[model samples]
Target: MKYLLDTNVCVDYLSGRYPAVTRRLQAAAPDDLRVSSVAVAELRYGAEKSVHKQRNHERLDVFLREVACVDFDRDAASAYGRIRAALEAKGAVVGPYDLQIAGHAVSLGLVLVTGNVREFRRAKRLKVENWRRG
Candidate 1:
């Protein structure tokens, strides 16, 4: 199955904070993995604000080279609007970037790999998996 790596998952993988997440990523076929452009933006923002900005940026560069980055296009925008409206109607709110990543994943039909399962659960018809759990 195809998987979309969330920002948190990517952070854990890069920091080696979660061995299971790292292992799962290593074990998966390269073509089966993807990173949403929204997630990339989040990562870049984190890197830019880090104490070790240069080091973090270099690490992000290396990681980006290994995984494919998918753009959030018109279809993803439609998905985002639908997801946001549905969540608001239910009084369930997901973070702005998280919602964008969710929309990207849902638009492309990819399972979202994240550590924040409860937060992502707010999005309907979006499959979420926590690789940190092994």
Candidate 2:
């Protein structure tokens, strides 16, 4: 199954904080792994603000080389609109970037690999898996 990795999962994989997440990523086919453009933006923002900016940027570059980056296009926009409205109606809205990532994954029918299951589970029909759970 194709997987869209959330920013927190990427961070865990990159920093080696979660060995199980890293092992799962290593075991999966590189072609099956994807990152939303919104997640990439979040990664870049984190890297830009880090004390080890150059190192973090290099790490992100290497990670991006192995995983595909999917843009948040028109389809994702439509999904975002529906998801946002639904979550709002339920008073369970997630953060903007998280919403965008969820929308992108849902639009492409890809499973979302995240650490924030409770937050992501708020989006209707979003397939979420917590890689941190191993």
Candidate 3:
């Protein structure tokens, strides 16, 4: 099964602060892992907003070459609208970025690997695992 990695999980892997995350990722076949367009944008946003000398951006570029970024297509948009509306009706609104990531994961039938479990739980039919826990 393909796994959709959320922004925080991507950050931790890149940061090398968690060997468990890295090991888990390494264990997966490269084709089984993917990052969403939303995550790619977030990574770029974080890199550009940082005061460092483009270190993160350079690393992300290299990383991008290794894994494909799933596009936020029509299916993802439909899922996003449904999820956002449901969450709003339930009074459990989440950030747009997180919603986009979750929507894409759900639409593509990918299990979402994220640290933001609380917020992701707001979306129905979205499978989430917190690699940060291990």
- Total clashes in model 2, counting residue pairs 3 or more apart in sequence or in different chains: 0
Candidate 3 per-residue lDDT, tens place, 43-63, comes to 998999988738988999988
Q: All candidates' lDDT scores?
A: 0.94, 0.94, 0.90
Q: Which stretches of candidate 2 lie over 4 Å from their true place?
A: none
Q: lDDT, candidate 3, residue 132? A: 74
User: Where in model 1 is the C-alpha error above 4 Å?
Assistant: none
lDDT of 1 by residue, 1-134 (tens): 99999999999999999999999999999999999999999999999999999999999999999999999999999999999999999988678889999999999999999999999988989999999897
The RMSD of every model to the true structure, in order and in angstroms, is 0.7, 0.6, 1.0
lDDT of 2: 0.94
| Candidate 2 lDDT for residue 43 | 100
TM-score of each: 0.98, 0.98, 0.95
RMSD of 2: 0.6
Candidate rank order under TM-score: 2, 1, 3
The candidate, 2 or 3, that scores higher on TM-score is 2
